[model samples]
Target: MSIQGSALPARPYRAFLFDMDGTLLNSIAAAERVWSTWAERHGLDVAAFLKTIHGARAIDTITRQALPGVDPEKEAQWITEAELDDVDGVVAIPGAVEFLNGLPGDQWALVTSAPKALALRRLQAAGIKPPAVLVTAEDVARGKPDPACYVLGALRLGVPVQDCLIFEDATVGIRAGEAAGADVMVVTSTHLTPMVTAHACIDGYEHIHVQRDSDGLLYLQRLAS
Candidate 1:
């Protein structure tokens, strides 16, 4: 399905669950550069390989490739280290910092495929504060496309997964959020090509507003373009 610019529903979502790399910030350049180098080292097609890396754990991505003599765990660690050292082009998605800061600290969580250290480094580079409830690659046995991470994120925030809204920018993450029974909103800031998805999309958080009620429940409002 083609992406729709439809405003999200005005559900009284209890908490927000955000995907890090693309939804909260743009780290595409830094991430692709590191992955490209790794791909080249493994004699893999850089472009093709990069297409599969986003929204997935490094170890899972490497394990799927079945690269000869490559230890997925070790290679994943190397990738994480390289990513940690290369935050050159990382930047917040438009209005992301403000959007995040306005939310109640305990009412939001970050669910990311990047390991905790690398996730922290990228968030620092982008000027986004680390979320109180962070579910990183090491926190789950599986990654995006699997609901474990999102499930755990909502769990940690003390919210029911069904009462949370997930913001994501990749197919795998969208699927994960849906599988976890949360509503999904797509962030389109880093799209290299038009994305096709059934979820409502926002290019950035500039026009998205949040209001917290007296009961502390959150509601989202998107301004008309």
Candidate 2:
């Protein structure tokens, strides 16, 4: 089942850092729902607002979406409330749970733009409890496209940034991992193109496999046959 001539060298990937929203879970629907509701309530275009805020932090999005006379902090609070309470459309991406369960908690962590309360709530709705280190928006001064989240995740995992492998879905997340010096793997859950151009496309767990024991130790299986 090994890839006989793949360009990526076969090596033991020491650590794993994961992006939450579009990467591990299909939360776009939920995100859109909340954002749309807020936008419509605020007399903003839902479509345009979503496009502007995709892959951005809530505070940044709030500032961008702020009405001429509205307070940024007030708008941000509203966004947090709307997003945290809206989970109707949240669901795990294909193979997400399996991939997570197959990974050792000690070797991996979740790095997300969402704050801890929101991230944990979404993970719960998606039915996946986050493991050891969960780096949220509050943990960093800068969001994705800035490597702080990935770097923090690696540090919390007790692994060097160079030894970490990141799984992300957005260009920003991928860039963050790359900036952090981790080997970045992109999943196509939310991507629209064919040539994903990140690290790899895990079509299914059957293709890119993993295994975890009772003690939480993990190992990757051979590539799909």
Candidate 3:
């Protein structure tokens, strides 16, 4: 699918960097459930809490929102436990499995704010193995909107920043990708709004401009009309 905005050149994209929770995996339900439970426990409004922390790191969110009256460390642990316990609804995002399975192992990696333990559990719950090169929270000093994660992911894949394409579902992640000198493609897997998607190369999974072939391999192609 040829996306609108700026007509990106048909360059050879050597690496595809992806965000985990809302990008490759459908873990948002579990996330919301976890957040709601924690919010209710702390007498906070669920919807408002989700809105405030939707695209931020758990540590940052805890420090800013869950701290003061609550122990940030303890609240984060509870959320982790809650999310793992409610992994029943977690699964790969539409076309995600096919997309990952078809890609060359060396050409892609996961860049996520999720810590390694949570990332592992979510990937397992989704029935997919972690990609060869994953930049989890443990791997980064800073989180999304800082560009560190995307930069590390691209470096791990041995690809130039300009040759990478990132798929993200959050505004922070989108900005991270762009800041890392990559093109950003946004997928609305979570509670994203039309206005939030306005500056992104947003598209539905069905409109993804790439495909898998018979050899169980993936390749990028422009969507033709």
Candidate 4:
């Protein structure tokens, strides 16, 4: 699919919500290594497993894709521990650090499918600071495409869901953000295919600048198309 290079209309959004793995931090290699190894060990189909696992929670993927009778909790715990053990290749998405650092700390939050421990390690590996409000997989009963995590993030940030602008790299995450009533923007740093539904798609945060007005409304400006 061709890249969608349209402009996201300016809005007076009160908060920015971010997805960790692909949107803010590039962890494709590390994740692929972890999940594929788990899949191989369980004799599961690697192609199908990789396809659905990226955007959702490990437990959800295990229950849906892993073989029958597998203990979802145990499998999820193993994957989470494995991820934490090897965050060596994870790094900040281009422009992610600057863009995040520029925002008002309270006006932004990270809502990720990763468990809290794994999420914190990845952020540290990428040299990105965890936001004041972080909604992890453990924080919600359901994961992406469910909107539970995103909704919780908004509430924790003390902002209305409708007042949020979300940055996501997966279709499932986009669904969650939209369902949460926030305008979702896709980041192409991960998936390049035309598989996501979002207000706009950006290559990375490299060309985007963010600030807040006197009234605390976030001001977002894309320096390039």
Candidate 5:
């Protein structure tokens, strides 16, 4: 990652694509509470399981576990219900509310591994409004690590995938954005330790600013440290 506070290039990005959980908001506390409980019930290592869960759909993760006698779909549904009931600690990442509010309503989209209702609940808890375009788990057959969500997000915004900038915080999401041919800005707000990546990274939206040209194209820049 470019940790020296490099400014984003002056490209004519037409839309901003954001991943919800760790990018726009912090829901780790609530998510871990439910997932850890589920992990313990399944006799899995809580910490390791938590690491694998982020940026993946519940069903996808559960299917990968291949827990004996457990139906992946049913287990995923249980996890979803638990998460929906537990948004107590959800809150916006620093400057997320202001940053999102400043964007033109139609110029951005939310693409998340979370289900639609859960996504809305978390956004509400974080004090961020739902975007004009939201591509949730229900909207796609596959989740992160698959570029479909990101591609669909850009399509819904009426922009070419290459003309969009994606904000993501996880490896799976970064891969998805890159595969969709969009520039990605890694958000490390939820990271517990430093990570090495090829894309430009930001800890939060506090120092980032957006500009719109006469033709309505958007540009992102970083305020000098």
Candidate 6:
């Protein structure tokens, strides 16, 4: 369960990009509540429905699962409202605060599938103040696995895509960052097992440390297991 033995070596980069839901915010409990009701209404297998929600737009997931002829955006909006109201179990991922504090504010940004409003609420509920540069679902024409969101995030941060590192916790987000030509690291907090393909896997920021060089590159190192 620890990154002590088989973790990746220390690395450096110009900027760090992060995903919200599974990466920084641990809101699976709230999310499951919303999605459970949605799946029930649509007569979908709950387990399969949950898997499709990760790292994807709510509209996209709902449209794909809802019965034919349903207004996907409308259904997605209903789910979003439910999610916004169900902030009961929202919490920040372990070590996320310290990790963000250690990095220069301008050197990092957030990219998420949630709309800006929902993203703000969740971040605030988790006590992670929204950063200056946040790329939400509304920011891009497409979501994860398309590379558009991650690519836009890097552009907003004024960093070259290849010079950025992505911290994500879902299969789709990993694929997105990879497609954007950036190194990706998966956080093991949500998925204790390392199943996703990434450059490396980490438990959380607890075992990881960050330092910035005069050249404006951040160095990330993992503690001894």
- Off-target runs (Cα >4 Å) in candidate 2 are 1-9, 41-43, 65-67, 193-198, 204-206, 211-225
| Candidate 3 clash figure, as a count | 2
Error of 3 at 42 (Å): 2.2
Who is ahead in lDDT, 3 or 4?
4
> In candidate 2, what are the lDDT values of residues 107-220, reduced to their tens digit?
889999998899999999999888889999889988888998888888888878878778777777778888988776666666544543636555334356665456443455
Tens-place lDDT digits, model 6, residues 89-111: 88888899888988888989999
Candidate 3 global CA lDDT score: 0.74
Q: Give candidate 1 regions above 4 Å deviation.
A: none
Q: Which ten residues in a row have the lowest lDDT in candidate 1?
A: 1-10
In order, the Cα lDDT scores of the candidates are 0.91, 0.75, 0.74, 0.87, 0.91, 0.84
Better-scoring candidate (lDDT), 1 or 4: 1
Cα lDDT tens digits for candidate 5, 1-225: 235345566687899999999999999999999999999999999988899989989999999998899998999999999999999989999999999999999999999999898999999999999988999999999888999999999889888999999999988999999999899989988998777887878889999889999999998877777
In terms of lDDT, the poorest run of 10 residues in model 2 is: 1-10
Look at candidate 2 and tell me the lDDT of residue 152: 89
lDDT for model 6, on a 0 to 1 scale?
0.84
Q: Give the TM-scores of the predictions, in the order they appear.
A: 0.97, 0.84, 0.84, 0.95, 0.96, 0.93
TM-score of 5: 0.96
Question: TM-score of predicted model 1?
Answer: 0.97
Candidate 6, poorest ten consecutive residues by summed lDDT: 1-10
Q: Which candidate has the top score in TM-score? A: 1
lDDT tens digits, residues 191-216, model 4? 74666353688778888897678899
Q: Which residue pairs of candidate 4 clash?
A: none
Residue 137 miss distance in model 3 (angstroms): 1.4
